[model samples]
Target: MEFYAGSRDACYEAKSAGLPKASGGCLLANASLREGQLLVGGHPFVIGKKDSGNRSSRDYYSHKLAWVSEKFVVLWDEKDKRGWLVNGASALLHIVMTSLEQLSPAFKSICLFDPASIQEGKHPHQPDSATEVLLNINNRQLRIYREDDGPPRFQGQVEICYNMLEKMIEYQLIVLERVRNSRIIVPRAHLEGWDFRHLAQRFDPIYPRLAVLDTNGKSWVDFTRSIHAVTLFGRGFGEIIRPTGACSAWATLPCGKYYLAACAADLQKIMDGHGGQYSTPLRLTDDDIWYIPDKSTGQCLCKDKTDATHSDLAQILLPSDMCKNLSLNPSGCYQTDRGAFIFGFNEIHQWFWNDTGNPFRKMAGESSDLLLNPGISYMSDSSVFRESLGIEEVRDASYLRLVPQQMSSDNYTVGIICALTIELKAVGALFDSTHAYVPSPDHDPNDYVFGSICGHNVVASCLPDGDYGTTSAALAAGHMCRSFNGVEFYLLVGVGGGAPHTNKQDIRLGDVVVSTPKGSKTGGIPYDTVKTLQGGVHIINGYLSPPPYRLRSVLRLLLKSDPNPPKAPLQPYLDQIAQSVDGCGYPGQENDQLFDSDYSHLAEAETCDSCDPQKCIQRTLRPSTQPRIHYGLIASGNQVMKDSKTRDRLGEEQDILCFEMEAAGIMNTVPALVIRGICDYSDSHKNKGWQKYAAATAAAFMKLLLSNVPVSNDRGQRQQAPMFSG
Candidate 1:
């Protein structure tokens, strides 16, 4: 730039300009194409027209000009295909028009720039220092984000990613989402180099605002092949930014070190392709914490890390020695007084302990420090991070997982609890990205899986195999509440018997039933526990709690979407489940046989094949196979209703539209809404054939419902990375 800055050809400089909007939306074309103008960094710039001498001068009107240190401006001349970058200094270096278009493709596609959109990005440590700049590109998006390199910088050069200005013209890359970590700060008294000062123009907490790319779209997956998709927090579960498939590989830090981390399944495949000879004899190819030993000597070897690997197995990783004082924390790593290190698996925090003993390994000294402890976390089953980081969990439940802490459990906001493997399958199939298992507390026996969908992080759990009924669901829900924090609400999703014999709903097999209050009774009614004296069931202490306002509000919007909302919105999701999980497809209505309430499924019949069709109840044919969603009171109990008479009697008594085994118990444990896909009429005719499709319908509805639910209660705000260098 210094070379070009000296040439000083017929380049342009701005003294002042005017706009009706009086904001920054101007493209510096020749007079013809220009229509409107905007202020840049809160000041208007004018391109002085040439006199007979071909020179330009400042034309100061009533508007005051900003200082040299106050603004950074871009003057785009679309007519001449030229643009300039000015730092409020007199010298204006022209930016090659090709570079700008390389990332955005067409200049015509740019939106009107608003001064409000330009944010002041400062160093996290030195808050007022403005030495680094970032250019973020999304699908059809060109935006800028700022990051202060903090303590990670080498000398004065920024450590945060900043190669965009250098490479945009030749090789353009698309960033998944804009970079942001906006937690407020108080400068650390002891830390030496990081004394942050508030800017002259303070920051808006919602910096780097962007429209997240559609999770179902393939554009990002294809784009990831060439460059990394850097999601700042809760990567896998948060849908933060996924480097997915075989192309999902990158150095997972901003310091520019090539520290390649991969899932257990992907480790070998990545190493095989990028293998290089190391300076040491050991190849070091596998991706797990291990120690190599001499075959003859049979002694522990290469012991320098993982102090609490046994008792702390997958919980935390403290640098081998822990009986010491501490230094600073970077990202999540801490150095102790003894020079041993303990790093958080991520950029946030977690607690640690002293021991885990195994017969195969030697004992290390007791970890003594109660100081700030860093730990490991996963966003999936066998794991759920403590919800204290930014991750919007969910994806197509694909297998691309993250081991490193891109998402903590706090990253997960919605909890889905299922009771069977088929039900779990349906829920898992809908995850935006399936997170690697993060071990949970021993008391939480429920297996958890984490993901992000629609704008919320989702954590799912299943009751142990062969477990059914209220008690089992209660235990699972209790465990989830204990381990997976930050969940705003829970959805008990799975299959249940449809009590369509009642006049309220024509719920057929595979239709979805959402629990909504009816009359004076609430949504989920524990009919089995209710007092049934005087031939009418007495309220079982108000039956159940009303659905949470967040859920109720979303439901109202869903119902009001249309008098007859087409199945179009949910088709894509249903098709996804059908394709991923076999038998989840609509199991033709021909197999949907509803027998007379008095007629029992023949004791010898496996399906309805041998049963008398003449005795079957005739019902109106549905217009299509699309699952209809019905919202009303649901009858919940401890026992499965295999008798149709009991089911109808309960429905009529309780004003129920559906019958399920788990909801009563779950509602008692965790305040939630019960959604059941009608697998069969609660009768002897109930079979496993409709379970999968039924579960799919319920899960699809859950996804659709969430699509309308806002990421409530600041849950979407990611926890900021540590700005202090300890």
Candidate 2:
């Protein structure tokens, strides 16, 4: 056991004067030695001050115990001296006393104390210190005591008392300053040249805050990375800067060399574009440690400097104009008029007359400016970047596509600018600049029109003969074509008649008479009877055609704009037919009934050009302008009637309005709706007036129908794109 007691500010002691060297000793290793702690042989002692600079050395107190072997120390209780002295093997008092006589004079003075004195209960008389007392041993115990406890009284034998008393006196003498041996500071006189006092003023006049320090730690004012044996109070020599008006000096840790001891926050300000000479500190790229200059220059003078890398910015275009005037092979490099350049490839060469001829490659042997080859690069002729430069290489620049200035007004001013990729398939053969073709109606086994249905396209074909048969055949063909093409509607256009009718009739021969859902029995439609029934049959009494709901709105607007709707002239021949058909006598009682109807007068005579008695004739053809229109139903049959009896019977049986030869053949495949300008009664009294005027009426009516039919695109919600139903 070992113990400690009294105030921490105390002297230390040792024992064992003039004795044989002993093997063991004990100490209060945790706490610095304090006064009144019992030493070997019952002597009291005190520990010394740490101010002597010996606090850091392991051997500072070791010299006092030189007589003992390094490994052995006896533990004893400072206050309760009755406890056993712990040695490796028990020895007699005589042996221990003799061993103490062999110790060195210095070693004889050091004391062995109890560690338990440190545990003395807190008392008013004793001032407390933070140091702890540790007794190092195997199973060793410590004891603590107050000064009033008096020196420890040993419970063991009093034999060899004089020798023990002698050892105790020597133990008390062992107390010495704690900092007796160290090496980190210089005497005050040695720091005279350091100028630490005038650090603020002696610094460079312009670089006011800059001060120099000897990086080597050879003087009191100097510093090193660590403390040496000479350190002040056993610590390193560090700089202490005490600013004016400050009670305490601020300390900075010693570094390998001089270091700026400024606030890291202030250092950051210098690096952030502040107006200071050392605005930015040089940094070691790998580690973030900054090298602040000793002098106030912005540059760093450290041997381990750093390294780094950098980047830039740029625009693009071409060299010259190459439109129409370009030759096959030109001499020299055919530069763009602008001279800004890039190498050209076959892809670019192919596009020489592309979107807006931007000559890319020029051939050799032709004039460089006038002609171009197939492999040179040139400027684009488009004015997209016109403000930059002008291109003039003697080529027809006008050939470059010129967009109308009005495009901006309609918001379509933008054009595509594409870079060359690979060649496109040769598709120009199907188009003549204006129209782009897909598959043809003839070659296409599907029987589809070239363009129809979806409404985005148009289909155009010609009729060799312009008559009801040809026209009706075309209409039938068109309807069939539309169905095959997935077209949503049909348009029948060309010419037709304007006729007089009995319902206050006053229609001109040439003026258009558009069909309005009119058809008579033998067959009839919902659209026919609902609004068109009059005098026992469906008939058109006016010129306006029935427009599909969607197109009707816009067509109405167009019609409203026409100021002379009623004054438009009628065809001369249609007038003659109307007059003739009105006078023609009917056959039998059926004839009387026909004359009794309002549309009987409207019926014009059908005229046969060749007067062939074998073929049936058309009464009249309807007129229209828009191609999507169709005339109301006309009769189709095989009988050619020259007799009044047959004509009246035919009329009575079929309620047939106008007769024709081909429509029935067509109706088998197409949904037919015939619009006939009533031509004649088809009796024995057919006249020359019937032939001329009927033809005229047919032509006029055809024109009228065409004029009235709504354009397909304007028809009710357009049909969707066709999918392959098969």
Candidate 3:
């Protein structure tokens, strides 16, 4: 682990040259990286590699860079085996890391680095002492085995425990895309200081289990046979298990008998307690299943379903409220009282807090842990099964990576971007069926959730939680295009502010606004810049590219086909969503008032409850509360339009029907259409009461829009939208 002195000059800003030939298309002159180690943001990186095999090693690791602007140079720390991402795409030489660390334990390593603070010395060796010396796990202390006068108990409990382990492994493999498999076993373990810390703090209380990750940094397997397992975080890592010196050939396989397994010491204790009587092992049925009584709470109770021998699992597993539903039964199994909303599914995972750690780790010391080994950890895209870890170690070309053509990102023909989590949820509700999670390349930052609508495959994404504004939206759309290049068109669908540019427009809360080309302006957001002149202040408007010809044409066909129809085409979908999910219905006309242009909301209030009702502009009520769809230009900017004066001026001057933060940033990046559900008036009176309903309206319309889009490879103009049935 030695290297020659690399270039001392902070990374050479190679403008137009030195990009790897493999990345020809992404070779934007604004950004470039070379093949060797370069000091970036005072750290180091081995960038732009050609040979994937030579890219990373057991000691060092590499991950795909979703974005690499000259301003934000991501660097790899070979010493710590992690990659560091700088904050903001435009922060050149300003190495301010995002607060991803604060968000979750998974990302606690991401922090503001002061190059001067790094002590250039080895970590002070911790001398092994009485406090540091940990012991081999004693299975007896796990408290998993207990006895009664009847028969040897806990066979059913052990099966549940084994199933719980499998459930944990399955999520890591499919959803988290971290574990290679779940059969990693070791005859012995040498727990160290780090292992002792994680076991006591994270695993011992509730997340009880011993999971092992490969040193090659590939995948992980949980060996929670009976809680005698060690907690090994990927970092601070000391190898616990391996082929010990010689060839230690062992086949780790799943066994059902592991549930009722007993040692000689346990048998003697049982015999002494029961007056020299030999106890028979109880046979459990329904290997690994959880009977969930409340799907909403996601709380469950388990039953062995064999002879009535299983203990009351609900008392141990169910939440406090669930205690009411679970009833005492003669079979020893906790049963949900008759006619309860119970379903059966087997998945038991520790509740996750974030990239950092869970709620349990919050009160503890600031200790970091990589839940999965990077070697086998799939990219952020939850393509957990991206690679197959052979039963034996990889010696040659034995493992084959299978990526189905249908599941490829290229097959996802449409892209949907939501600025908020609520918007994401609204749009996701309309998906006919979600596609399987696929692994993404290292460079792509977006973790796409794929779904289908009327045979159209859509890759949906939302701005990272708590992030908004045009720049973030643009960065997200840029990554979306690069990750899912085959996405023909994108929809920037979410909630926005209503302007009601003209009296005839009749816009209100829970109404849908679509960007439609008017004269020289292709429908999109107009960002107006204030330009001061000698006589008067003039506005210099920045325009963006319109939606693609294909989408605009389809919109026209859709409108024409259902011109003056009996009702709104998206009503059915909106109703379905409202019925399925709570609080996504129309907020009622009383909650949908528009304040006068000069009026302002009462300060420091969450809602308009404190404001004078007289300030609300009186308008003729529509025959029905169904939202009217308006097609016009929208004003987009980085700032929220909360000032009533500015909202009116911009609406009148720019002829804008709606205002939003993200559309302007995305319009230039992709062939995108901006569909906004008017939640607020872009005024001080804006409240969240209408946001969910507004989001629903926008999503409903987008569903209607996509329903009219024929899935066949026809980028040309679409005919009448016969699919629209109001």
Candidate 4:
């Protein structure tokens, strides 16, 4: 290679621009080359120029920018078959070179330039005896094979052997021989600097045949057929078959066969054993499967019809104390074992038990390893799949992503656990007039609640906001941040507008509204009474949420019997709320209906003065006929229903016992319950005056309910507690 001079100013300019410095000014920038384009520097460039000058054989070589350093720029060309650096000397000098035709297909050689400054070189390379070579693998190692020679001659004689002649990517294979022992074949990459002891940790001694298959079987093609089959062997069972090119293929051992396979790739290779090549030719096939024959069966011993009964399963498995009873009601397949409850048509996954004890209460769906056709599911309105599902090869498109309609709720479904995280963003009063008070600093935020009494319930209120605007924002933030980690069936306890009947029925100003699942039946109601009144009415409108069976039973019992209704005295809480409103700073609006509504004039015999609350009721609002707590249907929609007309419209359509906010958002996200205290008539009369009192009442009721409920502790049991029995 000959030395040539370019421009002295140009060299200084390139150096100042963060490029390598040279005696010649600076190499003019390749205006046509993109940032990542490959190029050769110094010696290769000088050689190319000389070859062209001589008019002899034009150097048939492709140049590539290996990397760049501050003082020196490394470059490679096929013709020179060596790596060289361009420095300030303007001399063609070899630095380090690899005897190879092309770079590894995995990582391409590209110019490294600082995006911040065009003149600055991209990569930082330093002088070192052994350069840290990054091999871009075109083909991955597939299998490990071993051969035994009578009395091994060389012990720990590691030989790096590679089939350089093959068209496929050239990968180094390490062959280690133990004197008079078997020859071990492993990929040079995996065994490099690997401690034999550490390597042994990964290999199980009991399982002689080591098996490494793609966890996310993304490749549709059989592995036995892939041409890029890299094999390794460890005299005995220490064979580690790792894929070098891509981790998409699935590997399996054939029945009664000792050899592992990379059967999918089209390339064919023979297994070289201790004596010679293995007798059987390894090929990729659908039926071919391999496993390290274990004395212990891999089958799950949870006890079923095929093996043990519920009693046997309960005893054989640990944590038997957690399991209570196995209700094999319909069939043995869908039986409920004590610890883990399986709910499905048969063995097919319908849904599994989210045992309360489990940190993440969730149910996993069936997953596949196919890259093209990934698995997916709907979780709280979000599409979920897995990405990069395997060991970084075969790109995984299957990832779980959630997109909720109501981002305000800050609600999201937890994919790992198959549960919803509910945020109770707002539970406040936007005071109209009527002498109602606005939410203030003095008010207790704990007045809000979300949970269940029949079982486990959660109730909470927003932290105080110094300013109303700030308070509202904080409340929204809090609700949006309301996340249920793994609890099953989230509940919301708060206040809502309630219609007052002639006799006030059995409900009072501070009663509870144990809402069913959004679309669940409340009494005879279908639960999804959205638009108009029909033959039967449901509790909620908008997105439907079916209440769990346990709640349904409890509510039914409460409705049937109201002999001793209003179990707790909510009067004190109500009175406190009334007084709090008196301190609010905001003035009443002229159109405030709170002042105009005549609560005293509306008597049992007379009709409602403003909006008729009764017209909204699809059916007669009868007092509880059952002996349990009074549980009525509630409605939930995105919009806050304050108008008596709209309330009546929804009521007549769905027979909603109360109207409140947050439940729809909560229920849609998780297993949620709504407990609302009757504050207003849910009509035009809704005002701030009732908010304090209603909130207090709701809070008290929630405490009463929480004290009496119990949740299952088993780690794999489905939530199945009954609500009531009317």
Candidate 5:
């Protein structure tokens, strides 16, 4: 084969010699080419060089400056031959040669192709009408057309397209070498006559252009933007991208059966030998559709049953035989002896499946995954699904991605338990803002109100209106612990009866009493005592668990910082609540009254107005309005303390500072600090007037203590608790 560059006469001579003309103004001798020979130009050829005028020359220069070349290749084919023409090969070669000449002398003798050797088919070459050549170069595959077979002419000359052909050969060689050394294990069945060229063509256009086909082979344009498929092999899974760029996974279980999994977990179980079979075997059902949840968006794959045409959002339909062969629950969820196997539905109900037999369907054009229609009560919310599946609830993506490490105990969670709605509201007012409520499966009818206070996540719970006392408190605390897993400590804050004594501490109305350990026992003790006459005296032994050491340390700090605790700054919160017509407001400090234990008078009276002034114990001076905070033991029992003599006796024996009905129960479930605002003196004068102010004071003190506490970190080492002197 002879290759020429420069004049058009050279091409005419080649034609006279009966040689085929190739693109880029070159000719090839058909006879010599059949023997596998290579030919290349010795120098460059300058085409379109016309001497028009000075202005034309400037215009040509401008054109060159503006020219932005594109990547393209030409495809041509004959009766039995086909090849590709690499666009811009000539220009690229010229640039490469110029650069090489300046780099080293060795490049001077390096010829791209030999001109003397006129042998045919000697070097590896791009085959005509071959798919391998096109794939190797990452070019879009196209049908090979011949001159007689189509309107466009076809030509094949090895010498003219030498530069592009050489590059294609180099790329193919590199690919072949990598495959030879690759560690990818292809099964023996797949290895039989495995032609990569054919595979490339088959999977060409891996990404869909305009539309994709559903399981039923029906095309739809508004498909899920990016559906992915992964294959599970052994213990791991791999992603498979089709030529049309649709992603899906395939898994072959140890049972020697292949199945399509909705997500990684379904296939992962089989890999782990954990009976991780698909809810229903793929073979048992026809038109069996599965949806995977997108963890990021909290959305699931759902099918629009109302649409006549098959859509991505429409229910997946499996073969009727497959459905009949498998045993599925009414919801179409797979049920095993262990439990139901619902894929993405395990986490927030991101996906919904419609059983073919179900008569009800979603209304047309409603795209949301949430089942809003009435009568559809079985659909799982994200929390319920995760709980039933024994998986953790899917949290916000930001929290998941940013905090990869497990939550630390240092990340303090403060749980506030209130026995009344007023108490709950008072505590909630201390926080800056409330968090959006996301229902949890473990939480009961009265869900926790979540907020943030002083950088700590505060979860507040209130007992049902009719329920109060230790038993109810224990149940509420238990629910809080289960639902809010990371809660480090709890604060039982509400109103309590003060145990004022003539000696020791002067506990008064509206005073805050905080639970502190006495010796080894907790400050809050259950006084559900049974008086037994042993020999000559009655013995009273109470039940108690020591408060957490960290809480004790915090109490010590709070006392050491202040000699006389000042009234809590809680008026703002009280005022905010008072604005609401249903809210409780301050009952006034004048209403606070302290009566002698010996004095008993008023009966069935709403206020002291009916009582005789002389009967009431007279005082020379009135006590200050500032509420004092006291730290000592608190007695907790099922019954509300009313008699002052009984309160004094218990206070003297146990050195208790206050009495409340809930703390003892919470101690049974969680190590907590009991903060109670003194509403009454545990006397006949007890009334509901002081309950609101007492709750406010306790909540205010809680806020102050929490504000001073350092945020917990992962180190787990205890830090110095904050101290408040007053």
Candidate 6:
């Protein structure tokens, strides 16, 4: 075992023998020599001063000598002639020695009286002067140390030992400094005259605090106060700068050399080899060691060398642990060392490093002269950069489409079908707002208008101009269903011929008629069906389904209520239609005269103006002038019911309240309520004057009915009918 002893007598002996005097008037034994019996008496030895030309060497040697002499001490008893004290003044020496002994078996077996194996060098007292001692401590083979006697020898074993010992002392100082001021000094070394312009260009955006220093310790460029000082040392040289908070140091090789040393170019080469982009930032820790091939043709980046493509280049080793407490991140930074020259794959922040100063302020200052000129004031109003970066291309108009397919199904639940344009206009005016139109692939040219009415999204559509009858209505309903997913219920709102029966009901002109179930038929009855033999009896073919029971219950409740809430007035909607379209004005109650079912009018007359009033059949006087809302089955067919005889026959057989051309067609596709305003008595004396007024009354009643119906949350899905049995 090796031991060290120091005393006041030893300090005098060391000075007389040309040895260095350590702190506290003591002399230090050669710790590396492992002397068995160390005497406390003084011996002459000289501690040489470090060269002033190398500041790093001076600091390293000075600090390391002071620490080793003060921390560890061994003493001998001359009278007993045996080694007694280990660290004579320190109370913690036993604990430190016990921990050391537990760490290594070699330490446990070491004897302080005899350390001949450790001190085998020829110059035992002057261990630093012996080249063999330095080589042994540095783990170099004894044969190589004996053979190499050139200047390279000075740069090898001795330099390695100095660096190691210097690092140990520096670590202790770093811990002490960190406690005093939360900062540490990092050592760095780099190549001579290396160009850092490329590295600065890429890394400045990510690491704004980066600064480069030249070999003379002068900064390469002026930097702001916010920038951190990054010292760059020349090859094989290092220095301890003032403690800066969280700082890093980088080492580089000499100029024109690529793989001889670790530098920025080596990191760049790794990035370029891997497609110049990373999926994640690469992190390099201080303790990591990376090895690069000395020659350019070597397989430095390849994971394996099974193809016999290995190069004869010597390996360049980078021991990053020499610079302690560093975490290097290669994100947007171009010059970063990643172990084994492998680039990570990650997103990079390009402008994260150098964003300290305001670039706009510099630009404004440069153009101050132009701004001062009165005639050049317009230049400040115009921005060339803004205009260049603005959107410039106009989108194609052909891409725009306005159709029902673009409407959202979730927004609408009620679909309104109008047989005439006037009918569509009346209902459309009740809508709050129209939605954006979307085009459908189907060739149906029906115009669809979307709006909300009574808290429900209502889509009103009209049959193409000149199109009439149940078949056309069926096609329009199918197209609407495909475009809007499917509607909850359809409101067939328009004018229809009144089927007034003497014993059944007192239906009159300009009154609204809501379709309801009667006996076997529900909602609207298709009167055009041809009777066929079924079980030896005539049966109605292609029977239409009834309107949803929920809607029917609401209608029944409204009809049974006293005074029917006075019917929501339709005059406002009628006036809106009149202002927008001519001839859609109210045709007046006088024009709404209901002729007897047996009366027949002149064939060529457009209105009752030229017709003889004496020829028109008169009706029984009604009690009130106000329009009434009637609920009964409405007869729908393909043909217009202009003949009084056919209308009466169908009315008596099916108990129909009104006759309309489109209801049968729509009822086949969507379950709906057919609301009609009686315009004529289903007789030959039919006039076109009362059609608009009748259409308006029907639309108004529809708005009232919708107000009473609850809004449903049934998107496009089918809903079960509410039970009406109770």
TM per candidate: 0.47, 0.23, 0.45, 0.27, 0.42, 0.41
Best-fitting candidate, measured by lDDT?
Answer: 3
Q: Encode model 5's per-residue lDDT on 572-674: one tens digit a residue.
A: 3343334321335556555656777887747878766666665555543335455677877888999989898988887887787888899878987897888
RMSD to truth, every model: 19.1, 47.2, 28.5, 29.8, 29.2, 37.8
Instruction: Give lDDT per model, in order.
Output: 0.44, 0.24, 0.45, 0.26, 0.42, 0.43
Clash tally, candidates in order: 38, 115, 17, 97, 48, 34
Query: Candidates 5 and 6: which is better by lDDT?
Result: 6
lDDT: which is higher, 3 or 4? 3
TM-score of 4: 0.27
- Model 1 RMSD in Å is 19.1
lDDT of 2: 0.24
- Tens digits of per-residue lDDT for model 2, 512-608: 2333334433121121112356576644232222334433333353346433232222222122223223322212221111121212222354433
For candidate 4, what is the lDDT? 0.26
The residue-by-residue lDDT of candidate 1 on 98-139, one tens digit each, is 112122334324423222332223321110112221121121
Q: Write the number of the candidate with greater lDDT, choosing between 2 and 6.
A: 6
**Which window of ten consecutive residues has the lowest lDDT sum in model 1?**
189-198
**What is the Cα-based TM-score of model 5?**
0.42
Query: Could you give candidate 6's per-residue lDDT for residues 342-449 as a string of tens digits?
Result: 111101210001111100111212332221111101111113311221212222332112111235655678889988877876675444334444444455545566
Q: What is the descending TM-score order?
A: 1, 3, 5, 6, 4, 2
Q: What TM-score does candidate 2 reach?
A: 0.23
Model 3, position 556, has a per-residue lDDT of 83
